[model samples]
Target: MPRTVPRLVSAIAALATVAVLAGCSTAPSRPLEGYAGEPKGVDAPASSAGGASWTAWLEDGTQFAIVLYGSSTCPPKVQNVAATADDTITATLAPAPGGICTHDIVPHTTVFSTPERITKTAEVKVVMPDTTLTLPTRQG
Candidate 1:
């Protein structure tokens, strides 16, 4: 009976360890916000009025913008922003620094101007860790 008890305890410990490791392996959840659809081709220039910063325009004329809310523990770094030949606006956002951020939602603006005018059929795509947001262009 003594040997059986020890074996049972060992099995339980192994199961507990597996459960803890499985929980730790789960990926962190990042909730996304802002519009994720067709962009209304409004001629209004980018402004910080709504806490959204204009990122840029794609070769096909799609507008890109970043909508910021909540306190970021680290500033969101822009790694790359470019217009591809296929008329898609591609952007990569770097991970923020490690720090404590407030719970308040703060809106910030970023504007980008391109020599090329907006195209009626352009699309915007923002890529991040485990997340992708695609915004299509809509006729005004």
Candidate 2:
């Protein structure tokens, strides 16, 4: 009985340790300000029938802003900061994490034109990874 008591106590202790460890584990947290860098130059891409899309890769920051201008009929472009890739116009974007980011703007479905073309220009700002590369509007 004495030996059985010690084994039972040991088992209980092991279970408790496992539970505590499990509880300590959590999903990795994404930092908002962890990315800190500069904005890089901008470039342009070939025009597409659907429309144009702009992308700016951050050089050393976690957030970035992109200004997109469309035709007079389209909505006015504005600047926005991104926390996650989903925060941008496209959810699939993978902005470089940790002090580097990318900004991409795609035309919404509301765009209407026989051969839709963005009449205006796009401005991009990147932050993080310590390098900035701007490509001009490319077809979406």
Candidate 3:
């Protein structure tokens, strides 16, 4: 009985130590939030080339960035700063893929402003190609 007491105590202590280590090593997870932006509207023109636009408004205390996914050919660009307020900045569309081309805008990073104020409206433009062609074209 005396030997059994020491063994039981050691077993409990080992389990407690394992529990403490497991709790210490576990990581905490947080929910992902969307970017701070208000959509003004989207614009697309005909003729398979030329004018296209995308606009958005940013809110206060939010940081954001612009990302463009495009083919190896023509790429998108962030145009002018359309509007700027005390706590906001607006950007206009530049040019990007059009004529059956697609692109994705991803927010890669964010920068915080002082006093937690809004900053930047976003804009993007689509530019069409003269003609469509497949990639990795084989030469005859």
Measured by TM-score, the strongest candidate is 1
State how far residue 78 of model 1 sits from its true place (Å): 3.3
**Residue 126's lDDT in candidate 3:** 15
Best model number under lDDT: 1
Q: Which regions of candidate 3 fall more than 4 Å away from where they truly are?
A: 23-27, 34-140
For candidate 3, give the lDDT of residue 64.
Answer: 29
* Span of 10 residues, lowest total lDDT, candidate 3: 131-140
How do all the candidates rank in terms of TM-score, highest first?
1, 3, 2
- For candidate 3, what is the TM-score? 0.24
Q: What number of clashing residue pairs does each candidate have, in the order they appear?
A: 4, 22, 6
Greater lDDT among 1 and 2 belongs to: 1
lDDT of each: 0.45, 0.32, 0.32
Candidate 2 lDDT at 46 equals 51
lDDT of 2 by residue, 14-41 (tens): 9999987664433222322211111234
TM-score per model over all chains? 0.39, 0.23, 0.24
Local accuracy of candidate 1 as per-residue lDDT tens digits, 65-112: 444443544434444444442334345554665768666545432323
Q: Who is ahead in TM-score, 1 or 3?
A: 1
